[model samples]
Target: MADRRSAGSRSIAIVGPYLSGKTTLLESLLSVTGATTRKGSIKEHNTIGDASAEARDRQMTVEVNSATVEYEGLRWNFLDCPGSIELAQETYNALIGVDAVVVVCEPVVDRVLNLSPLFNFLDEWEIPHLIFLNKMDRADVDFMQVLHALAAVSSRPLIPHQYPIGHGHKLKGFIDLVTEDAFQYHSGACADPIPFPEELQVEEKSARQEMLETLADFDDKLLEELLEDIPPPQDEILQDLKMELGADLIVPVFFGVAEEDYGVRPLMEALLREAPDPSATAERRGLNDADNQPIAQVLKTYYTPQGGKLSLVRVWQGQIEDGMTLNDVRVGGMYRLMGQQHQSVLRAGAGELVALARMDQVKTGDVLTAHAPAPDLPVARMIPQVYAKAIEADNRKDEVKLTSVLGKLLEEDPGLRWEQQGDTHEIVLWGQGDIHLQVALSRLQRKYNLPMTTHQPKIPYRESIRRTTSVHGRYKHQTGGHGQFGDVFLDIQPRERGAGFQFTQKIVGGVVPKQYIPGVEAGVRDYLARGPMGFPVVDIAVTLTNGSYHSVDSSEQAFKQAARIAMQEGMPRCKPVLLEPILNIKIAVPNDFTSKILRLVSGRRGQILGYDAKAAWSGWDEVVAQLPQAEMHDLIVELRSLTLGVGSFEWTYDHLQEVPERFTTQVLQAAWNTK
Candidate 1:
């Protein structure tokens, strides 16, 4: 029976919010499918999905995990994705290659809002998905109420496929709406069919009618039969459910306590019956030519300590076999990933998700095909980073290794970024949040054995003169052969803000030779590298109005020394000010959180430019503000906390502004200490 269903393989992703029992549900699915003899629990740190040491240490999934199973002869590959919003990009990347997504969620009503972003992405991309209301035994609300709450957040119709027989935490079983039959769950076995309870008959009938009405909206025959008071056949109803689900006309909601393995078998059956086949999914993704060369896409990339680079890919067309070359890169080996464990496979046919080892050049979301040419696969857009920190290796000897590891880390997770800031000379690592960076650091220590230290990045501050004065500079040295002598009078003046440094000379009557004039400019620039405030100087002008130089003894080097002397005497007379970097940040949040965001910006010494409705995003406001880079390190943390983890921002360097008088002392002290 399983072999009959295994005619073709299919891949699906399990996605949801954190602590939603997604991994627990995966264990149940594997157990019920007979892929494993016993189910693993998360509390015991024995689950198959969250198999990585980092995940086990944190008790959360930090990366995408894939497990393959054969149920009733059907080959099924499930991609279990991380649930934290900080790690949502992993789920999004895996989603692009799957035939469908099983959205797991808690039965809590208020928390249903947490699924808004995931649902929005699924709808926007037209990805087929279903809802699995997990932890039913712990739910405190009515099933109908939960359904309504879920419907409010989804853009499609919610069709209840089963109605729970019991209420609240004592959920005993559920009645399948299509078959009109009650089924009671066993401790660790498939549910047994049973007769409907007499007391709940009315409620069951009503739920069944609602399900039919939803399905009828998508089926004319079903609607006519219902309107004429003709009961639809069970097979006919099942067919409609399958067709509607594949078309993404409705989201079929199923209930279960995954820890107890209840409802998992039924959900698997639904997947086999209703989920679209790989051919249909491929056509939907625009990979319609099945006879073409092998085509695939990378869903995730892993750098295994033992196996090296493994590219988790979904085969979209043709077939992939060992010894074949894809995009000019040789295929070393293909294996099916069972958590961190792998099973070698000779070949992967169309629609199978397998890992191709040693494909170092393939990155997540890249398309792989034969020499003919790869199609432009649909890729998920990158989310802008909101948090960052300066990081460095604890041991200086490992600096080169640190860079190589950072490249691998970024290839596995594009959301992690690092760059060396030119001004501050700090290597900053940017990510979605604090935890995201922590995970990367953990990976660095665990996978590459590189320990790191992190801190808030230093702001690239500038120093400028507020007042000016003129002074004479002279250089004289007596040596054995000759004496070096050069003299210069410099006029220093403050330039307008944002008007960069300017150098000019007015020496005439052979006072200073033109050939030596360039040396004075270089000397002034060299001095500007470190100003009185211990920062690069800007917004000042220096002129060599008068200078004397010897024909033989005075050279460019002597004139340069003289110009440096003149600046040393003249700059102290010019009062210098410290300037802080200001970033133009656009913060997007729901309108309800606008006031709180405004207060946050104000509290951080930010200047509000203006605010308006974000383009094309209803009920959200974009607050434009100029905030000092010093305050931005933790801004995303606070913004998400105030906006229910939905707030985000994108920023760019705007300009430098004068540091307030009150902060000048502390800023200067900090700068001195760092130096």
Candidate 2:
């Protein structure tokens, strides 16, 4: 309807569920724009979007891939993000700086629920997005049914911008509802205009009227025209689509087969016409344009093979030049990226996504400016880690190198977290799921040559006594000149749960010297470090009732040895039991899968505390339960499988509970085997 071309640059993210053809869509966009000589296929392992070694090996996207192209005198930066639920952090982080989003999905109604979380995030942030129903050539269900299913999950109204005109397994073309123009698809070429199909005239008219009614909900002029049975002009309808879509009020839906590049060009044209400019995005983000200072935010970070660090950032407000200083760190170099390949650029203006080399002080989610202090821009919060593994270098000499490389790894992917667990005395890595950690471990070996050995993290088990006992110990050694002589009596008992450790003493006059009493407590603490069950001892108390010491040869060291002897003899008699850490977990899942999750918890020896509707989340339930840490290792893996990969949970240490009699032996044997 209008030949208007937008000015400046625009950044859009392609995001959806795994295997929904997001990367395929990116490949088609790059190919149609002539940015690449030819397109790459996922099966052939040559696609530019999933270019990383880890991604190629797994045949999936593990991180965000940035590519730039120019079309119709407008520059567009497309961020192809990971589709797996475990790698959603990469998608969320990249979405923060984008002007709009293209949500790619299949036409299967059963799988449409997978888009709920993505829609929820976009709506919450007020980010404008449109749905591209890819793989229409394989469609087996009615398009209207799929659209209705999508509408059920999204908060915003769904308006069909174009209606598919072919039957199942053969998508011929689509009719543009705004213009009522029909087109036919061709291989690797733009669609050709064709006459309207008389057989489908009624369906096309109804669909067009529905789209107009949805748009009219926002514009009174359109509403009057529709109410008075007067047809709205083509320009007015296009304007309404652009305004409503840009304001995030309505999601316009388009259908196509991305593999055949059928609707790719039309999707690109719609984006060029309907998407908002960078200035509009800046205003929406509250960024001041008149400040004349450069402000940018890091969407991702990378470490090159040559030991170079690159920060991929979006220039939100001002132009950034090579060697410019930001946050006390000078930008070493500036470049635009197409997959892993970098093209040198001297300066990048607002709305451009570029890579800045060697900004060591900057990190993902950090806002950078040319001035002294950078402003704080909102960033996506990392999802809670649901799986963990204890990791160490395969070669002992590589331990220090592993530690150093892991820092780089975490900087590159904030969703990953690592820590030195004090209780278990193991280096543990936590992530969204098993696959997420696997990709990180692969990076360790591929990038840094640091191969790692991983296993389920220890449960941080502890030991506590069930009964009380008093035992005496004495140490008398005579060596020709000076001899060691000391005696002690220890009373050991169990404290209440979570009371921790306690130490006290009662002595008669001059029985045990005051100077040597600390030795007794110190020795007891050392013994508690590894108790009868081969774990740290907790919730226990020790007291020294009476002891005799020789005035000449007695010392703290002698007393310490005597106290150790006492504990070694008395602890076995106290009947110590194994205590496993229990986690208080709150699981979030759609209501349809609530019952299945409850059964899953039961199978894991977890006690269901209660469940209720998750606050502010309709059709979702939050189940509260207490599960042993040992059972938590793979809970996320199964939970996601049961709930279409959208279920998640958050947990904290609840308390230590005694292991069941039946499982105690297995637990102890496993611990011993590891040692």
Best by lDDT: 2
What tens-digit string does per-residue lDDT give for candidate 2 at 146-205? 999999889899989888888677778889898999999998999999999888899999
lDDT tens per residue, model 1, 1-675: 553465488788999998998999899988888889988888898889998888998899999999999876668999999988898788898898888889999889878878877887888778889999988887475789899989987888999899898866677888999887899987678889888888998888999999999899989999999999999999999989878887777899998888888888889899988888788788888877646578999999999989999999999988899878988899999999899899999998888999999897779999998865689989998888778889999999888888788999999998888999987888899999999999999999989989899988888889998897998999999899878887888889999988999999998898999988998888888889988778899999999999888878998888888988888878878988889889999998878889999999999999899999987455679999999987888999999899888788989988888999999999888878877
RMSD of 2: 1.7
lDDT of 1 at 217: 91
**Weakest 10 consecutive residues, lDDT, candidate 2?**
1-10
Model 2: residues >4 Å from true position, as ranges? 1-6
What's the lDDT for residue 209 in model 2?
91
Which pairs of residues have clashing backbones in candidate 2?
none
TM-score of every model? 0.95, 0.97
